[model samples]
Target chain A: DAGVTQSPTHLIKTRGQQVTLRCSPKSGHDTVSWYQQALGQGPQFIFQYYEEEERQRGNFPDRFSGHQFPNYSSELNVNALLLGDSALYLCASSPVGGADEKLFFGSGTQLSVL
Target chain B: AQSVTQPDIHITVSEGASLELRCNYSYGATPYLFWYVQSPGQGLQLLLKYFSGDTLVQGIKGFEAEFKRSQSSFNLRKPSVHWSDAAEYFCAVAPDISGGYNKLIFGAGTRLAVHP
Candidate 1:
């Protein structure tokens, strides 16, 4: 009912600094996934958190990491941010591990890596 | 590996006109396709999805997408576009790996502009 919610609608960070974005999945949902959407481009998969562990990951580097809590909330951390890391970081939530899952997205955190 | 391609970057149409956005995907098996719409500074909203049944899936907002396995494409369509329909549309494919649904792979997106 509440849908997916993200914190710090926007953020600003300098190079070599780190930032953490938070996400609260929709009610009655458990799995949380993170995505990065660059300007003029679609979102690219970052990683997925299920059962408090990272279950699946995309082609992103190790600098990108995430955590899922018991309450099903998630946090995405980016270390040693680069200028290219400036993009919209989106958080999505889905239900069980079924083959057909529907993802609900949050407005996203606009990360501006200066 | 999975990927999606939206051929049109931007499309402009007058109000009350029909709309069609093209999407193509590359995957190993039957792809689970989806269409999402995003407004400025907003998250992607699911319009419709294709899992198995019908080739034509109807979504909220009067949107419909046709999944063509032969062409490896899923195109979105809407009749009588409204001004509010002007927004970014994204086509995505969910990769099935190890008996689990993986995160979606999205296209560059198509931006629609409607003139009143």
Candidate 2:
């Protein structure tokens, strides 16, 4: 069984540019959540998407957004990226049932904002 | 709001020495606790979790964690360290409420360095 998959394992961007990171949920999972891990820090929650709708979000600004497709894949879009936005974007997938605690994380996208 | 705290920013241990990473949490009730380790340029991998029933949970890599309700602590431990054990370890928690989805709040992390 395939675990969670993410695209663009590494990326480079500039300030004022936008970037979209993709994640394919683990097999048999339907919910996807995005996180940002800055250098020397832990991962911070970005938002969660279920049924293609954002169910919850973190303290991040509106510039950070995400979407979940019917296939349970997800996309995290950052608008007008800032240098501080440069971080490892992590994607975690879990089933939509009551067991949200058991999550499988994908190898994150290391985003570098130059 | 739920939060996790990993007090030790970094630690060094000998290859054959025992290891322990401290973690504490703040929550109204017993929350879902977890320990994850990450290698360089890799995503966080779940080591162990405490949902209910057992306070001591065993996980991969011979890692184990004991949840102490009174102390609000979930500390990870291992009998011996391997060179490959050198990585960043994180503690996380989520509200145990059954109705909706809860996000895992992670600590600042503790970087473990193993020496030969």
Per-model lDDT: 0.91, 0.89
List ranges where model 2 is wrong by over 4 Å.
A96-101, B99-102
Candidate 2 CAPRI classification by DockQ: medium
Query: For all the models shown, what interface RMSD does each have?
Result: 1.5, 1.8
Taking the tens digit of each residue's C-alpha lDDT, what string does model 2 give over A1-114? 989899999999999999999999988888888999998888998888888999888899999988888898999999998999989999998976845557789999999999
In DockQ terms, which candidate is top? 1
Poorest lDDT segment (10 consecutive residues) of candidate 2 chain A: A95-104
Backbone clashes (count) for model 1? 0
* Candidate 2 clash pair list: none
lDDT of 2 by residue, B1-116 (tens): 67788999999999989999999999998887889999987778889888889899999999999999999999999999999999999998876455343488899999999999
Candidate 1 per-residue C-alpha lDDT over B1-116 given as tens digits, one digit per residue, 9 for 90 to 100: 57899999999999999999999999878878899999998898999988899899999999999999999999999998999999999999887645254489999999999999
lDDT of 1 by residue, A8-110 (tens): 9999999999999999998888899899999999999999899899988998999999889999999999999999999999999888655336888999999
Candidate 1, after superposition: displacement of residue A47 in Å?
A: 0.3
Candidates, DockQ: 0.75, 0.62
The interface root mean square deviation of candidate 1 comes to 1.5
